[model samples]
Target: MKIIVSADIGNSETKMITRYDGVEGSECFHQPSVIRKLIKSPQIAETNLKKNVINLDENLIAHITSSALNRHSDGLYVIGKKAMQTDLNKVQNMNIKLGNKHKHDIPVIMILAMIARTVVKDEFELNGALESSYQIDCDFVSAIPASEFTFEKAKEFEKRLTKGDHTVVIHLGDKKVMVGINFKKAKITQEGIPAIFAMVYDNEENDDRKVSLLDKFNEVYDEEMEPNDLLKMKIFHVDIGDGTTEYIYTNGVNPVIDACDGERRGVGHATEDAVIMLNEMLQGSFKSSRQSFMEIIKDKTHNLHSEAFNALEAAKGTQANEILEDTFEKIQNKAGNSVDLITVYGGGSIQFREHLEESLRDYAETINSKLLWVPEELAVNLNVRGLDILNRTVFSKNKK
Candidate 1:
């Protein structure tokens, strides 16, 4: 069996799109980038779990199922939303400054877990018959932060992913099913440049929905860009991630790598700040990881809901200012002051959109440059969308 995929192993979430033959499997899927090793694996699912956690628009699905992943790792691990439930859930610390995240076990584990999630999820849709144990060949495209991306680094990451068969065991209360994964191909594009490809390709039949986003972009940004204008424009992009920010310049269809660079410190700083404040409020009686803190902010009925929201909101506001200021400075240094357009996107971009839009719109008007916070449709999943497009492009070529 073969699974083609496009993934972005982000610090906050592992976002991906799985393809069968040459088309996307409905749409994208994301796993919270939380992983935890279990000393004792819990009893297999007693409760009937629902498929596809929550439905986000545009065929996107989130994974929350708990499954054990052993992809060249030291021990059995739980990932996605399931890992967040563990007391010792491990998340990639966004505080690390360009420290090569893909070099570690986390990326490999997350990628394998993502593939497993897909496999377990549309089992009947798979081309071949399913068994208790079957091997899957995976061809995929994913990206790493520009701050840490290099040809050599990418090659190393590719080697890490394809080294051997990865095992993912799914416990279904009565029995367990194990699936083996083989890396047929993997491509790690730098984060800063892929969003443009998102504008270029989409697998869905009713892709005209994307036009609404472009319309929104034009109306708010005071620009008159038709469908084809973005790809033709001299574009500057600021991708604000959890732990880092990247600046990439694209003249027409080509990315100017020499003008693309990134630095540490992004929305992760706010997340850390909120976590510290929350822990302090609890008087150190309990511990909460970044993942938990986010959940706290989302849960309004939680005891510390108000406190968590306020703390996170305040921290996010401050960090947004700092990140945007730092971004402009870096843009001037690397990508220069003038460009036909400027756009920003990422998970960080979504969380900090209000602040970013207000400031960036004014900043753009000041320089007479059009600005887009990159419509919500293309926001957090921008890189993965682009990578998926690239994956299809490659897959089509191979088929030919």
Candidate 2:
């Protein structure tokens, strides 16, 4: 069976979806970009074991998980997280002097490889019917944000990924309001940045402050808030499981001012916004079996709103529709006249679609461009799709 592995490898999480012969299937996983490493007695690359010792190079054994986590015989490995979880302490002082950032790329490669291997193993077992003689298919499509994108980095990713059957790494970023597209082909195209967040911001103004639960705060803690102080306008960056949004400002002013919602400051605000949206939909009478807001994200929405269907239904009819329209308007205002297309994506894109379409429609009245609501399947994997297109152009010697 032919297999395709598509990944949107972002800072927070790396979401992966695999398909047999280019069709959707249930066999997939979303792994955090967290590697737990430990330097133990005898190094053994193990999956899901508590104390499996494995050799890192030779003398020092490193116990690694399919999650790319390694824990040492001592507690040093657990002291830090992410790329820092590795046993740099065990390495020579010279290597440590060169620093963690220098060691970052190699470890990232190892972590991704391990995760991919895990996906392969799970799929093979689940699809045991075909495991006997079926060819182990491996065509990968991975993506990185344009802000972190560079020619050399793309080449390096292409090299490491070559271990698979065939791979493509798409690079996506914003060029003004337009989405830039780069693919491996005779031709290269950089168009517009997908307006997923832009649409969200458009609806920001009219979203009953109640929806964000900030309305009570605005009233109770009544105070004239400055753009800088009361709201805490931070140039925070977020790399969702699918895409990255970096706050690029000049003299402390964001280019997409309207789109700025203070949520980019941290994962907490972003999570809170999602919760507030949920709570408001319940009309302040929501209850859930899932304990917290974070749980809502991991689980299904229907499950969370099962008890408040009527409130949710009403919320849909009123706030949801208006919010969507407002979102479209905001995206258009931000785009001005430069963009030819607005491609939308991310997990919330479907919920934001009506607004996106409305905004695109308003845009069509003046601009001669198309607003493509990349199909839901594509929405789930657009970053990978965009990255594949980028890899084609960046890696090709012909420079198409």
Per-residue lDDT tens digits of candidate 1, residues 66-137? Answer: 222233345566666766665643543333544587666666677776676567656734433335655688
Whole-model Cα lDDT of every candidate shown, in order: 0.69, 0.34
Q: Against the hidden reference, what TM-scores do the models get? A: 0.86, 0.39
* Candidate 2, superposed: residue stretches over 4 Å from native: 1-6, 11-13, 16-142, 148-269, 272-338, 386-400
Off by over 4 Å in 1: 22-25, 45-72, 89-98, 124-130, 202-211, 221-223, 395-400
Taking all chains together, the TM-score of candidate 1 against the true structure is 0.86
Clash count for each candidate, listed in order shown: 0, 38
Give one digit per residue, the lDDT tens place, for model 2 in 1-400: 4444445544334455555544544234443343333443223235332121121111122122221122221121221122332443332111111222112442343334433344334443565311221224344445334334444555555554442232211111110011111212212111122223222232332233223212322453364432233122322111122122321211122224333321122232234344455667668664321113334444456566443333333333443354344434544554334443333445445534553456544654456643334445434434444333333324233443
